[model samples]
Target: MNEETIKNIEDEKFRRLTGVKRSPFEKMLDILREAARLKKAKGGGKNTLILEDRLLRALEYIREYPYLFPYKSKRWGQ
Candidate 1:
């Protein structure tokens, strides 16, 4: 399908979801959890190491700049 059609489909799918959006911290937590799962599931590898590094950087970024996640608090009018 064309780009517009694809975008509309994705928008529709997103609108149909029933829950509030995840905060940046929550998202980072999920990433860390996934990284931990991957670490436990297999032996060490270059790809796994790279992914873990990326996840760590993401967590650090959110920690260092919490304002980046305004959606984290409903009181902020998010």
Candidate 2:
């Protein structure tokens, strides 16, 4: 989901959808953003997905299929 979609969601609904409260989600996003910045500084290749999208995808994967490796999943290619 995009930032606007996330912004319109109520706190409880967001928690239900992503399995984490808004505060923690933002905190996680901050960590991911820092990592992305560092990777960029190291000359890492650009990612197609933005940081928020990447974090959302990871959260969805964990919540929907906890046992599967993200890279091994068919949806990962998307």
Candidate 3:
């Protein structure tokens, strides 16, 4: 519901799935990267918006399905 509650749940599930903790920076990056990818897919002169919608859903799924969350390419909080 609320952002903080969602964040706590997200963190818990993320750690449970990946066996590691996620940081604020990583979360922000994930949100930003996912946004950029979807925007480009939509505005880059393509008509297949289904792919864009699927990418958006995949990003949302990444938020819920923590195991699918990729490891941060850079170490966070280290």
> Model 2: per-residue lDDT, tens digit, 1-78?
789988999999988888899999999999888888888888967788878888888888788986676566767774
User: What TM-score would each prediction reach against the true structure?
Assistant: 0.30, 0.79, 0.27
Name the weakest run of 10 consecutive residues (lDDT summed) in model 2. 69-78
Compose the digit string of candidate 1's lDDT tens values, residues 25-69: 346557777877888688664453444345445555666777867
Quick one: ranking by lDDT, best first? 2, 3, 1
Model 2, C-alpha of 25: deviation from truth (Å): 0.4
Give the candidate number with the greatest TM-score: 2
- Point to the candidate with the largest lDDT: 2
TM-score of 3: 0.27
Taking the tens digit of each residue's C-alpha lDDT, what string does model 3 give over 1-78? 333543556767756543446664356557766877889877866444443244334455666766533444234533
lDDT for 12 (candidate 3): 71
